[model samples]
Target: MQEITDETELRELIGEPLPRAWEKERTSLHELDRAWLAASPFCLLATAGADGSCDVSPKGDPAGYTLVLDEGTIAIPERPGNRRVDSLRNILTNPHVGSIHLIPGRGDTLRINGRARLVRDAPFFDDMVVKGHRPVLAIVVEVEQVFHHCSKAFLRSQLWQPETWAPQAVPPRAVLAQTLERPDATLSDLEDYYGPSYADGLYRGQ
Candidate 1:
């Protein structure tokens, strides 16, 4: 197999991007972008460290979880999760981040690129409280590039179609955890840990 090492070769194969693609980007949020943020409950945050290592973390909360500080700034609440903090560590090293916001049943997504910083406390923390828990930290982004992505990929995957869903087609989460992550744990124990009530502890920080 051969690789195309230059943009010239890559573009020759993929063809030039449509002019509208270039025209769609904005340096700040439009009214539509704010509306999109209001309705989106989830986003994928992409970050790279100073050494160029990368991480993509999924952030989800109720809709409007990402607060718009201004047309060019936004804040995302950090909910409890596996404490890896890969994205946060990367942001400390390299401020740049890219995020894609998504809403269920919607193929198009809102893309945001910006510089980010972590804040331990802010006046807005009170607004982010859910289930009596407020985020200990939040990611504030100075937006640079914002755009709406087209839906070709979602359309091809039929990701929003209920008929194509087959969540049980593979091994259950409990089985997988026991087989790959916790070999010493019994299947029954793993099942009890990840059973139907798994979501009950989402915001309960350990």
Candidate 2:
């Protein structure tokens, strides 16, 4: 195999960004930004540590789960999940973060790059609460840049096309649990628990 170790080789392989892909405009969020936030049910959050180690986490809720506090800031609640807190820990150590909000079947996505801090204020938590379920913490992001991202990735993956979807039988969860020696696990039990717990927010629109 040939090794590519030079900047020239890297640039030649990747080429230049497309004119439209190269964002030349900056837009600040306003009251209208709430429309986009309200429409998106999912978003990907990217964070990094001081050492440059990075983590990307997927967050979702019913539409409008994220709130636009103002032109300069927005809020996202932390829901119940495994205790790893990888993304949160990264944010505490490194304030910079990037978020991409997406709506299934939608071509355009909202992208935001900014700094984030964890907050546990009662009012903030109360604002995020739904069906009597309140988040333990929320992330407040100070927006530095906001823009609309193209849909190339979704198109390439055919993410919203049902015909391109694969069957859900691969690498069965039981196999995964067994491979990891999870003595207290059962795939069926996990699925049963997941259905109700995940539907918690759906019923009350959390």
Q: Whose TM-score is greatest here? A: 1
* Model 2 lDDT on a 0 to 1 scale: 0.82
lDDT of 2 at 78: 85
Return the TM-score for candidate 1, rounded to 2 decimals. 0.97
Runs in model 2 with CA error above 4 Å? Answer: 1-9, 18-20, 23-27, 30-32, 172-175, 181-206
List, residue by residue over 1-206, the lDDT tens digit for candidate 1.
89999999999999998899899889999999999999999999999999999999999999999999889999999988889999999999999999999999999999999999999999989999999999999999999999999899999999999999999999999899888889999999888888877889989963
lDDT of 2 at 112: 88
On the 0 to 100 scale, the lDDT of residue 138 in model 1 is 99
Q: Candidates' TM-scores?
A: 0.97, 0.83
